[model samples]
Target: MRNFYSALILLLCFVACKETTSGKKEAEQHVMPSAQAVDTLLKEEKKPAPKTFRTFENLADTTFVRLADFSDGFAYDLRYATKNNFLKEKVYDCAECYTRVKTAKALLKANEEFKKSGVRIKFFDCYRPNSVQYKMWKIVPNPQYVANPKKGSIHNKGGAVDITLETLEGEELDMGTDFDFFGKRAYHDNFDLPEKVLANRKLLKETMEKHGFWSIRTEWWHYNLKAGSNDKVANFKWNCNQ
Candidate 1:
């Protein structure tokens, strides 16, 4: 009778140990991932990289380039392409800002600085063709207002731009007068204006000057790239429909 009880106890102990081992095996199987799953976790999903833009390294300094093609950080309200300008007529077939590669480089750098101050460059005019200058002269023959197409202005050389500063929200800051306002109010030295207007002009002038551009006395918005003064006047026109 004693031997029979001892054998039964031993058999019960063996079954309990076996059940514990089986439970432990299932717990480990639930926690551990399969080899394929481990591979998937270690490998990253493939995705296309963003496109890189070309730099001016290979381009000539005089080569004309569309500003938007290099950087979209600028705002455009090309006045000559629309009748909103002083000419009261649309002289340009399209609204595109093209400048010499050297000029574009300086502009891009200047814009980068402006962005840090929560403002950006808004172009009123850029790279006016020699032919367009003649049309402007026909409407406003005054040398104070329009450059003679015969001699050609810095704008015809793809080196000059008329610009204003605006908040990132597109609200143009008060520069004392509207673009192409042919009067004393637009003069950079005319500090007789309000304090706010002078401040705005100062900001535009200082920031632009730091980027290798010089401002004319009469137009607060006009800036000429120092290097662009010598480039030949061009009649390069952009396609309107494209």
Candidate 2:
């Protein structure tokens, strides 16, 4: 009778242990993450947040010139070489010209207000080719007004703009020297300028600033649209006509 009881107890103990092991195995299988869930987690980890505003890279080439629809008579001198001293002899389409089309339209609308005041906007440089920019960079590697090509320029991206104020008669404003002049006369806060020139610069800066444009401290004529990300670099092919 004693032997029989001992054997029965041993058998019960083995069954309980087996059942515990089976329960543990089932629990582990149930708790393990699914392959689909793991893949989804990895995908989420890789994904970046969407930008709040549209960037230049997100835009098509055709979208860059949409501002032209809003205004007429604003000639693109880079489309054809003219005797304009401010223009580079080699014409090339500007990437920034397209990127800032919306800002350009705003500038045109603001020009209408300026026109009421007998003023017009004159562009010196727009989209510059990497080649031309490279040339300029070589000439003046560390210009106060211009950016280095090694670092990439707003002109390269079709986003940097250099312009000045003019009169309806085509006479340039006293905002100081000719455009692209590498001197203090082009400096934004050069107090040596005539009061009228200073006023004109102030007007241009204020108008551009109001329309989401920011000017460089070194060049009164240089302004960038604050619309796109700074990281966006454009290597768009330039057409002879911009």
Candidate 3:
């Protein structure tokens, strides 16, 4: 009877130890995943929010601002920033589009109108600094082509832009000649071209005019804001590192 009781006690002890081990393992399985999930949530919470475009509210019309910061709706080529321009030299350290607040406003409006026609404005240049004008003058040295830096053209005043229209897919519309083409083919008055090119030029001209921009007779791509012409010429340069 003593041996039988001893054996029974041993069996009980074994079952209790097995149950305890199984319970510990179950707890570990649940706790490990819960801890990992909590860690993932914390990482997600620490991440920064996505960036967004800035607004022009409360900013003075004369204030210079980067166009990309205001809206991502427009396109940029910035030819002078590269060697693709008439100067055939990379004049800018980096590509950027800056304009006076009023000019940006007019461009935004004009772009919106262009979008309605299934196209958008692509900028070749905008708000050229007075210093850059001087560089361009040294390269070209032609009053008819490069504006005299000393006299300060409308571009130096942060009001002028060289632009073209492109389809929503980014295919450039034919405007007869390339940008900075110093010839009759680029003339706004030249109508002896294909119907499509003429229509494209007409669309760009009429829309820009409606938004208080006036085109020069010689260059099909150049447009100056009528109000922006009075703004003082600026030599403010954008930071290329940014």
Model 3 per-residue lDDT tens digits across residues 158-191:
9999999999999999999998898999999998
- Which candidate number maximizes lDDT? 3
Stretches of candidate 2 above 4 Å error? Answer: 1-62, 66-70, 75-99, 143-146, 229-231
Best by TM-score: 3
- What lDDT, from 0 to 1, does candidate 1 have? 0.91
Question: 1 or 2, which is superior by TM-score?
Answer: 1
* Model 2 / residue 13 / CA error / Å: 99
**Residue 46, candidate 3: C-alpha displacement in angstroms:** 14
* lDDT score, candidate 2: 0.65
**Model 1 per-residue lDDT tens digits across residues 1-242:** 99999999999999999999999999899999999988886664554555566678789999998888887689999998899988889999889999999999999999999999999999999999999899989988988788889999999999999999999999999888999898988888788999999988998999999999999999999999999998898998887676
- Pick out the ten consecutive residues of candidate 2 with the lowest summed lDDT: 73-82
- The pairs that clash in candidate 2 are 94-127, 95-158, 96-158, 96-159
Go through the candidates in order and give each one's C-alpha lDDT: 0.91, 0.65, 0.93
